[model samples]
Target: MPFTPFHMGAGLAAKALAGRHFSVLTFGIAQLAMDIEPLVGMLRDAPVLHGPTHTYLGAVPIACVTAALAPWLCRPLLRRWNQEVRHYRMPWLQESERWSPQVVLASALAGTFSHVLLDSVMHLDIRPWAPWSDTNGLYATISLSALHLLCMAGMAGGALGWVALQWLRSRRAAQRQRHNP
Candidate 1:
């Protein structure tokens, strides 16, 4: 699942559920960070695709690093996105794009942890409890098709939920404006 968009389904779901408490952009960065080891392995044609970085223990450092750097990396991108939204007159997206440190850290942790958990069920080489143990007890917990379908379902549900939330917020704002003005 290296560089796969499927991993983002979980992030989307988290964003929908947690709302302002989760940073989807930071989550995305963490997902990419988690895959770096596998990318390196693929580039070198190494026998083991999932190594230390694919484990639960490995996720901590990556998550922390991602959290630390995400604010710096995502702010400019978000500003650009907001500019585009403003240009297009997308009032539904006009809300502030600022992310707090706590949200960044939480999102990063969620991203890396979820990546490992998802990969654990699909990949044979993912030793989630490495160092203490090399057992891959989670491998093939469900069929590959099932896993893919689950991810797709999450993506769909999360997207719809987020859209619905935005619509409700906009409606409420319109109502308030009509009453006040």
Candidate 2:
């Protein structure tokens, strides 16, 4: 999709928040969240599971458990980021208000699940249905060359189509609400 990084992140984060507030967004949120992890692949640089954990088998447990634990991860993981180059800083909230566990978890879980699913569609090597078997249940082959460009192309096309459909539906819904109201 042509969505900016912020929009994508916000979309998936919203999905995480949706678990506690299920409505029209449940599916969209899931899609957004699943899409997030695949895009942000800092791990891709490392010699990790076929380009930053794109394996379907790897994404599922991560999705479900992460979704289940989303509430926990979102509640201000107060830790110190002590870089040798920079001064040590602790991550804390600006306000004194405490976060709700359920809400926090919901945000994280949705984002995680969405990330896994989207990654699977994006990469054929990702075995979304793995752990059940030794082989990766990837939808696409992992040749990592121009020969397999079609695989990624298809995934990108699907995402674009999905985004277009969603935008159209939202526009129609807004029109309906505006006219009817």
Runs off by more than 4 Å, candidate 1: none
Candidate 1: C-alpha RMSD after superposition: 1.4
Candidate 2 lands at a TM-score of 0.34
- True lDDT of residue 140, candidate 2: 40
**What tens digits encode model 2's per-residue C-alpha lDDT throughout 56-169?**
444445545545544343333322211311242321111112345454445444444544444444444455454554344433434434323543454455445544554565
Give the per-residue lDDT of model 1 (tens digit) for 75-134: 888888889887988768754567778888999999999999999999898999998999
All candidates: TM-score? 0.94, 0.34
Error of 2 at 165 (Å): 22
